[model samples]
Target: MVNGPSTQMAFVEVDCLPTHRDLVVATLCRVPEIISIEVSARGRDLLLTVVTHDWTALSDLVLSRLQIDGILRHRTSLVTDIHLEASDWRLDALNRAQTLEVARIEVHSATVPSTVTPADTALIDLISHDGRIGFAELARLTQRNASTVRRQFTRLTACGIMKFRCEVSQESSRWPISCTWFCRVEPGHVAETVRILRGIPETRGCFSTTGESNFMFIGWARSVTDLLRIEKEVAQSQPTLRFLDSAVAFATPKRIGWFLDQSGCATGEVVVPTFSTPVSKKH
Candidate 1:
């Protein structure tokens, strides 16, 4: 749920030698760049969500750090545009009245900024691990006054550099199947194509990426059979969109900062992303 300003994210497919799959998964888990790891069923062995400070850093991660033993091959797709995020989606728990009431609330307080300071970095580092950490505790950890910490936290959120999400075990949530679709459409119809995908109820996230498949999206399904229905719906919605490939996540070892169990429940462990250098303030 935590993100940084100027962060670059990519979806990397890794094919591990069958015998070394467990070992490889364990090794990749320790890398901070590898924010999320999923065992895929249809296309690749592992699907990874990696974030870096910039494109150069991302290239270094894919070319050097990710070149570990037991990984037979890997492919990286850089995200160019994000149409939707998981945090933006909500479950169908609320009724009409409750949903309308919640929607009426204003969440944004401060104006978004394009840069962050050292103070922002400290706050982000702490909240990235525990989003619920209080202002007092954050002050104690960061060695700043509580009031200042609160102000800085507000600024960070306003800048869109700090965001929070509550993640639950997908299995427990009943939508156990996680699928990622790779598709492509004419450049002229990108906006229309994304609009059609967003109308699908199962869609969790949609993004434009740099690859043979320009569009990628995620969907959570009640069952494998439901995937067919969703795919058909997508095809019917946008005839020009071509499906390059699709991968179903059989297991997710990590998601964002939380380490998930086999049932997709958090194990109370977190891996906060490490920024190699503090963000410089723009003049």
Candidate 2:
């Protein structure tokens, strides 16, 4: 859930010992730094989204910490800049008026303290488990006044430490295939290339990174054939963009904080991210 330039994020592809696959996954689930864990269909065993305070912290996690017994080998791609985040993904479900109404409330609570407190920890943990929990229930669980819980909830969302999103099973949605592209864009054309990709409706998130590929994006498609069309669209728009690799996710066991079932529905099993509680907007 961390953002801004001070925060470090990377996608790591891990190849685990086949005999210990299940054990490896269970162990990774407990690592606070590991966020999104994808069980790929092929080419890799697991793909992880890991976050840390800086490059040094990231190196420590990747080089030292992630070298678990079952993990045979791994590749890390450090995200240098984020062009489009999941929060920026628009489903276009809300009309002008309804969107404006929601914006008004968000604007009112736009500013919050940069540092987290003990009270914030309790509130964050509760909400991370169940986003639909009522303010009264949160107050009861956190042992804070109802009004105080409400204020803290607003502040958490406003400061970008936590985000609320509504997701449906990709199998049921119009775009059923989940695609990720690892690409490299000429340094001078990075911004324009990002602009082009962001305008494309299928894009879920896009980032500029350091590794074999300098840019990468997650996109959705109606069918396997459509992936070629997306590639053509990007190639046509930015001739300098080169595709180094691509993947189609078979199953995502964990995303953000929720553990999903095969159908991509939340299973009520939550792993409240350890770093999410005290994310500092400033270093």
Strongest candidate by TM-score: 1
The lowest-lDDT stretch of 10 consecutive residues in candidate 1 is: 106-115
Q: lDDT for each of the candidates?
A: 0.83, 0.80
For residue 140, give model 2's deviation from the true position in Å. 2.0
The reply for model 1, stretches above 4 Å from the true place, is 96-106, 109-114, 275-277, 280-283
Q: For candidate 2, report its TM-score.
A: 0.88
Error of 1 at 278 (Å): 3.7
- Tens-place lDDT per residue, model 2, 1-283, is 5332356889998999999888888888777778778887777899898887567777898889887889999998888888987766767778999988887876333543556676777777777777789999998887779998887777777777666776776777788888889898888999999899888999999999888788999998999999999999999999989998887888887888577888887788777766633444545
RMSD values, in order shown: 2.7, 3.4
Task: Provide the lowest-lDDT 10-residue window in model 2.
Answer: 274-283
Clashing pairs in 2: none
Off by over 4 Å in 2: 2-6, 53-57, 95-97, 108-113, 277-283
Tens-digit lDDT string for candidate 1 (1-283):
4455567889999999999999999898888888889999968999998888777889899999988889999999999888898887777778999988976762563554655667777777778877789999999998889999987877665556666676767999868899999998788988887788778878899999998998899999999999999999988888988999999998999888578899888888878876333476679
Top candidate by lDDT: 1
> Please, what's the RMSD in Å of model 2?
3.4
